[model samples]
Target: MADNASGDTAGDALPRERKPSNTALAKQRAHIENLMQNVDKPIELPQPGSKKPLLKPPPEIVLNVRGSSAGAGSSDFHTYRELRRKEHLRIKLMEAEAAEDAIGEEFNREREALKRQDEEKTAKNRAKRQKRNKAKQSAKKSKPAEKAALPVADE
Candidate 1:
């Protein structure tokens, strides 16, 4: 083997050591100091009962329906039961749809009632304001007529 000037073989090379910068060393020292301060303080753990959900989704009344996987034109008992299962699922879906529609109709009726009530209130207020303005105008018109009726000396 040819000898190099450093007198160390390439296969026996040691890893180069590194020294951290002053800023990094200071940051590490500060982190350790902060950790030491927290060592005496008790860690507040979460309570087990707090894991309960705040709100739960509404229960599903209608389930998803998948088509029958049986072979076509087969009139076995499995196929008959599959047809019955589909009928039941369809009935459940119809019932759920009807229930949702009823809720929507009720909401619309309530909104319509509220709209009519608001319109009536505003119309009454408008009528009262018109009457008040007309009264004020009539009082002003009478004052001028009364002054014209009074006999006055030439100024």
Candidate 2:
């Protein structure tokens, strides 16, 4: 074990610390503070404009039609029954599509109504605030004038 000037050996030196660098620690703290500040922002309720999925075709039903069970090329194929089933499915699909369209129309109408209602509410609140402010200003103006108009005391 060779020592330059002190008696301590090379192996006796303490291991270098592996703590995060100062810049990295400061960046981490800044990120945490940003997250905390963002969390404090008021949460808005999901609007009706958000996605409401329309009807979707079933996977199994779609898979069944892709096979050779409909055409008559195969000896085991059944044509009439498949035709009838396809017709029934088509009719059912039309009906469902129509119903969904109607429902979507209704939802649109309801959204318009809610929007109108909110607008009216905001207008009413603005008018109320303006009226209150005017009243307060008029009251303040009249008070000082009234005090000034009062006759001086006899003393």
Candidate 3:
């Protein structure tokens, strides 16, 4: 019986006999009343959105200027100097690498040019050898024909 009484009293938290707050407060209190009524059995959510929307994000506030610490103190100066030193070293290393790459590229280009020249020279020499062989073959054929054409001397 006590449990049933508590269950009956659980939903009657707001007194209907008394008047409620006005404006947004009344709407919020009404929503709370609706929520309390459906503690176990939900019926419907508050219509037309919440009275005071709680899901809104807070405003953004900038806490510090960009690189403000760069000119702040001795520690900042040391950090700035160290960063600049590293940047300079990085640039120097990049320039050295670029120069090395250029040198290597030129070396490869020269080597390829030399190879092409050698190949062309070999090709020309091979063509000359072929021509010489063909001429020798033709001369040998003429010599045999000329001997056959001449009168054969007494054997």
Against the true structure, what is each candidate's TM-score?
Answer: 0.48, 0.44, 0.52
Q: Rank the candidates by TM-score, best first.
A: 3, 1, 2
lDDT of 2: 0.77
RMSD of each: 21.1, 12.4, 27.3
lDDT of 3 by residue, 1-155 (tens): 88686676755777667666578988998988988988998676567865432332322673434584465765667766866776676667668778989999999999999999999999999999999999999999999999999998897
Model 2: worst 10 consecutive residues (lDDT sum)? 50-59
Candidate 1 residue lDDT tens string, 1-96: 357766887757876677655797788998778878999876667767853224333336635334588454545567668767766776776687
- How many angstroms is residue 140 displaced in model 1 relative to the true structure, after the best TM-score fit? 1.7
**What C-alpha lDDT values do all the predictions have?**
0.77, 0.77, 0.77
Whole-model alpha-carbon lDDT for candidate 1: 0.77
